[model samples]
Target: MHWQGCDVAFLTQHGKQHLVGPPIEAALGCRILHTEGYDTDKLGTFTHELARPGSQMDAAREKARIGMALTGSSIGIASEGSFGPDPVGGFVPWNTEVLLWIDQKQDLEITGWAHGHAQSLQKPIQSLQELELFALEAKFPEHRLTMRPSHEDHPAIIKGIHNVPSLMEAFERCRSQSNNGLVYVENDLRAFCNPTRQNIIRNAASDLIQKLQSLCPACDAPGFWVDRRIPGLRCRVCGRKTRLPISEVWHCQICKMQEERAIHTKALADPARCDHCNP
Candidate 1:
């Protein structure tokens, strides 16, 4: 059951197919079959208690295998998201999106990356008077809220509210349950709950299209993309080796062919990037 030309399986508990499925279909002539009731949560979950089983690549490939097993489809797709401190700077929040494409027929796999600042879509209100301002900021009812006691006496004292009356009720209820009598309200980050995250998904879908379209020079396999870089570029000023990429290593999954190509850029690394010079 191919849509454009290729048959692929889409494994998701969330309705992510609405965002990621189309790009593969359009770019690579693929059809996507949804794998329902596949307990991807068993592999890992967002909650702190359920630690993810492996590195990003391993998890993604496992998800693809699960999809393929469910539908007996040769091609599969999956997406993963990790939200935490910025890799570049530890302070700011960073939301990283990863998309994985697998072609069992060709034994090829490709991944796409996207991330940016998340607006959070949340703000707190301590008083009834602040409701107007909070509503204006959050666009309440359109974007719902989760309210809980700032300090919990009972772990079950949490509420998800949409309407103004319910919001006020939940806030007061949570405050009453807290020893400090304060409530914290924030946006729910579930895909359906957060529009910002959905936008990131769309952007990652686009990136996947580009990755699937790319072909390996050696094996002519789809998803031939850069895996990593060989560092030790020379400093422009000192001629000393610096910590910058000198060549890019591209690989083909099906043929296990790897090629290292010199970087196109001629600009040498600055002294600041040199460990000996800078340190």
Candidate 2:
């Protein structure tokens, strides 16, 4: 509990503090000082109004730094999320959440990651019936939706439509402004708007807590976790090395300490996965 009794600055406008603060404070005994002094939408937005610059990790780190700067606290935390197609099949929608912790006193930076299915969908609607159908699929009232005239990049966007009345109103507004008589409707990807994204952010916070509890054996620093994998497990049929991990390399960012632990699971790689055997 190195962070016990410490004040950690958290910057968020999407009500993420409620989701991430409780577990962290309960487990680490740190104070979460919520800050809204800066507008995070300037960094990036899901609605495509302000494009997010740099990588996901970069955005999280920048937020943490900004929070620390604003609150003048030594430690800071921030969360960032992204949506895309699932990695395995590249078909289903996917969401990835990242929670970053920056401790200036200890000169340490740690990140927690969680990803899963996302409730993200978009459609072009020409009628109220089409809009209602899209809302049903997007889980409206609970998940919320955003409407824009003509296309996705339309500046005349109406956000945070929860109830049927609001949804209908926003749809009509966008439709009236639409030159093509078509409105673009989508799930609002904001954490407060999307419950699924909120849960993923919570999971990411739990992951960050786990890593924070894991102390580096050599330097006693936090964030001791697997840094890389050593590949080349032998193929079962060919008895030749395949591009499968045989061991994992746990690392400490502080002292740059590393420990290679061999994997004991299935001694050989699947023949189907082996280049030599399958070739």
**Which candidate number has the best lDDT?**
2
Clashing pairs in 1: none
lDDT (0-100) at residue 174 of candidate 1? 73
lDDT of 2 by residue, 1-279 (tens): 798999999999989999999999999999999999999998999999999998898899999999999999999999999999999999999999999999998889999999999999999989888887888899888998999999999999899998988987888788889999999999999999999899899899999999999999998988999999999899989899988999999999899999999999998999998999787
lDDT (0-100) at residue 13 of candidate 2?
A: 93
Q: What is the lDDT of candidate 2?
A: 0.93
Clashing pairs in 2: none
> For model 2, where is the 10-residue window of minimal lDDT?
127-136
RMSD of 2: 1.1
Q: What's the lDDT for residue 102 in model 1?
A: 77
Per-residue CA lDDT of candidate 1, range 37-146, in tens?
Answer: 58877877543325787976778788888898989888888888777777787776667888888776665667788897653544444676676676666656666666
